[model samples]
Target: MDQNSAVWLLLVTALVLANLPFIMVNRLFLMIKVESKSFIVNMIEFLTYFGITGIFAYLLEKKVMGHVAPQGWEFYTIVFFMFMIFAFPGFIYRYNLRNYLHKA
Candidate 1:
């Protein structure tokens, strides 16, 4: 794939993956019932998604850019925030969203 296409693919993948924890925790969009997960479990799942996405992003960087750039703390901070942003939809679903949909 072209660099541009690859970049878009990575971004979309990251967004989906980042929200997975919230989905699984809230038992949203599942075919079978899952027990509600505790806050600690949810947080762990969030961090796990972060790590997996980080690795995937790094690999994409290496493949598309031909080198892995040295990242500082700032890089990690930005990525964390981005992951949080991506998780917003799932958060809404777990909290405010379901309420609204049911009342609709």
Candidate 2:
């Protein structure tokens, strides 16, 4: 694949993978018929999954990138904002009506 297509594939992959826990947790809750939960709880679970994956990537950075330097608070600040962006789909899934349209 071309570089642009490859990068887009990676982004789509990341977003799907990053959102899986939120999806699965909500699915499991639905399976058991749980009602009324906080959005932050789902977001936190999603972030926990993303954070674990980040830790694994950091550990492998030496093999992948040759050198993985410690990042500053600014880097984390950027990542925190990025995580919010990443979580947008899940927020919409939970709050928006488009999900119902798919089933109709």
Candidate 3:
């Protein structure tokens, strides 16, 4: 694929994977079948996705641009917010949206 296509693919993949934790909790997705919806488990899963996505982005930058730039705390803060934004849809689906769709 072309460079632009590859970059877009990576971004979309990151967004989906990062949201998987929220979406898959309580068997909402077929691959996961966790019965407990504990806050600790969700928090850990979110953090794990954050770290994995960050590393993936870093490596993609290094490969595509041929160098990795130094980042500050502000950079991390922004990325964290972006990850949260990416997870927003899943959050709504699991909480508000799902409740509205119940058969009862």
Candidate 4:
């Protein structure tokens, strides 16, 4: 795939993955149904998604460049914040919009 395509793919993947935890609270990894998800559970799921996105990005980078590039703490910190930003929509929906969703 081209660099542009790969970049977009990574971005979309990260966005979707980041939101999955908030969107699907009934089950973990589509299994192990729980009555309710606590904040700690959501955080664990969020971090899990982050790790998965990181792996996907690493593979994409390796495929595009034929090697993995070394990154510093700054790079990781920025990426984590970006993932947090992408999760905003889901967070809002889960916390704010979900109540209205059922009432309407």
Instruction: Tell me the alpha-carbon RMSD of every candidate.
Output: 2.9, 4.8, 2.6, 1.2
| TM-scores, each model vs. reference | 0.82, 0.62, 0.82, 0.93
Clashes of 2: 0
Q: For candidate 4, which ten residues in a row score worst on lDDT? A: 23-32
Per-residue error for 36 in candidate 2, Å, reads 6.7
Q: Write the per-residue lDDT of candidate 4 for residues 1-104, one digit (tens) a residue.
A: 99999999999999999899898979886678999898789889999999999999998999998999799999999999999999999999988899898999
> Who is ahead in lDDT, 2 or 4?
4
Off by over 4 Å in 4: none
Which one wins by lDDT: 1 or 3? 1
Flag clash pairs in model 3.
none
lDDT of 3 by residue, 4-104 (tens): 96689777977896678777867533456777576667768888878888888888888877889999999999989888888889878876787798845
Error of 3 at 76 (Å): 0.8
Candidate 2 lands at a TM-score of 0.62
lDDT of each: 0.79, 0.62, 0.78, 0.92
Error of 3 at 22 (Å): 1.6
* Native-referenced Cα lDDT, model 1: 0.79
